[model samples]
Target: MAIRDQSYQRYDGPVRTGRSWPVIGWSEFRAYWRFWRTKLTIFAVWLLPLMYALLVLVEAALMEPGQLGADGPGHSHLNLFVSTQLFALALVYIARGCGIVSDDLRHGTLQLYFSKPIDRIDYMAGKFYTLVLLGVVSVFAPAVLLAGLRTAFFVQSDMLAEIVVLHLQTLVLLAIAIALLAAVVLGLSSLTRRTGWAVLGWIAILIVPLIVHAVGAVAADISPWDRLLSLHGLVGLAGDALMGGADAMPEWMPRIVPFAAIGALIGAGFAALNWRLSHLEKIT
Candidate 1:
């Protein structure tokens, strides 16, 4: 009886096998790279970041030693580096993210992806890696090259440690900023398939908070902590951190505020992305 039951269970119904995890991983990785290549072909991803990197090199080459001040505004390669990194982050986010989801939908590819065996989490994980990879390559890569050149050319033993620490700090901050920006832009783009509408959405997502802060900075005189819940607020906080590290801003708070805001923004953006993916399933 036991032998008969075992055989019966084996033949009870047809079994469906899912795609192997390794294959899925590879496929998703390849898909991400494909998207990246397509995006990179555009000028902003390739040309703009390169130009920005060269700009950093130029400015660093121009910097004279012992000119940076402890309390006053002056030229510093470190300041230029941070500022350039921030600008690069903004450039990549606005350029790449504007079309990440919109183009897929506009091209009618998103529906096919929805029909795949992959879950929303897996898809999102892939998207997250893709965005993070681009950020690393575009922002951190240039910063590293410039820092190396500067350290080799000018920095002393004492300044070397500071330069290393500053590079690490900038890397962490840039990663979080770019990742959060990607998620928000991708989520909004997914919600609406039109590229024009997506670009409009991106602007609205970024601009509204600045308008609020401008009001608050003028009237309320409160900590801009409330602003972090929005895009501009979060970037503004990160800017403070970058500027603080470069001695461009007054010293009062820890650099942790920007890190914390990045964490929260990324968390919220992922949650929203998950919601969008779930909705995609319903429609498909």
Candidate 2:
């Protein structure tokens, strides 16, 4: 019996160093886009903005010069689209974020990740970046493009300044919405190793609030503060405040409540994520 000597040989390669988070984020981002379903969903969602823009153009073409006032059909349509699209954005968040961390845990990939030069924060940040980018592409980018297109082709000269201001406000609101939703989904993902459980948790978090809010609305003894119980309602209120539509919120419900609720949700999510990851790190 002859045994051949086989020894490990060290090969020279680039030593990975600081700020590998972007590389991690980029890899995930590219991987997601490779899936046909993801590509299709993104295309469909982005088409919405174009459809709204076309509606604005059609309305502008058909209406008389002075008839299309500041509060015209185009304006109303844009506002409605922005408000109604939150649910779609939520779906995007769930689809992309629910499995990100849980998959790592389920497949025992966390050990491999931690064995590398990456810190837990960097790993979390990488996942967070991917989610945030997906949210922006699915929701924020489209809305901004729609606003710009409307301004370029449909807005009246006198309304340009006002429309631009509204667009900026919408951008801010969309950014906040994406950030908070991403945090919630990532936190949920960290809490479970099964992607299905994480998804179910996200659904419950979103839907249960709506159900409670609906029941409160129908009850005769409902308190004004009960409105805050609805996460969806709070998001709407926050959007209203951002767009200078504070009159839409209840007189008793202060404008700050919605912003505060969003802040609290984000904070709680981060805390949960930290706790879960820290425990996992200790175990490893």
Candidate 3:
């Protein structure tokens, strides 16, 4: 029988400081972007904005000077663009986020992640940022760029102020939508070990409420506040409000309801994710 010394020896290698979440985020971002399918989806989403920009340019060249006012044609176009971007956000969230956490769990990598230098929050943040990056690229960035292009080339001088205000509103709305949706998807991802189940959960959470809301809207008289049960309806209402549309919501419905609903959703998502990870950590 032989026993060898197992004394600790500190290596002279350079130590990295600061939170590693950003590094984790960047690494995940690059890895996802490397996939051909992801790249194709992003390109396809961007093409929608590009096509709309071309239409705007053609309309600007052919139309009369006063045909498009600040809040008339321009506002309509902006709303359409925002709606398209939101749709793209949903697709990207489902495609890219479905596997983020579930893959780690299914592959038995959760223990490996927990053994690293980062905490659960950092791990979650890292995975969440990947979806955020996709949203910014596929939805937010294109919308802002198209709006700036339209403002610069087509919008009139007198209407620039109004257009700028609308643009700012669009920016804020898009940011809120992206953050809330990312939180919801990531939370769902953390709950399941199978990617397909996570994807199905996301679809159920997003779609089931819409069906209920629609049936309620049709079969029974429901208050505007009742629409908060539908996540899609709440976001649509918020978007309408941002665009100053008349159909935003009934005056009886408080303006804060949409914000509150989205906030609650995001809170529940993160709470579920944290609880799952904490229990997993204890068991591992």
Give the poorly placed runs of model 1, Cα more than 4 Å off.
1-84, 106-108, 214-257
Backbone clash numbers for all candidates listed: 0, 0, 0
Q: Write the per-residue lDDT of candidate 1 for residues 1-284, one digit (tens) a residue.
A: 67756644346677566533344435544554566544563335445446655765776567665542223332244445454555555566565556555666667765777677766666666666665665666666766665565555435434566556665655565555667776676577667667678778777766676687778788978574665557555555666566455354335546677667677767776776677666664545
Q: State the local distance difference test value for candidate 3.
A: 0.77
Residue 280 CA displacement from its true place in model 3, Å? 2.1
Ranked candidates, highest TM-score first: 3, 2, 1
Predict model 1's lDDT versus the native: 0.60
> Which 10 successive residues of model 3 have the least lDDT summed?
70-79
lDDT over C-alpha atoms for residue 110 of model 1: 56
Q: If the candidates were sorted by their lDDT against the true structure, best first, what order would they fall in?
A: 3, 2, 1
Position 61, candidate 2: lDDT: 88
CA error at residue 180 for candidate 3, angstroms:
1.1
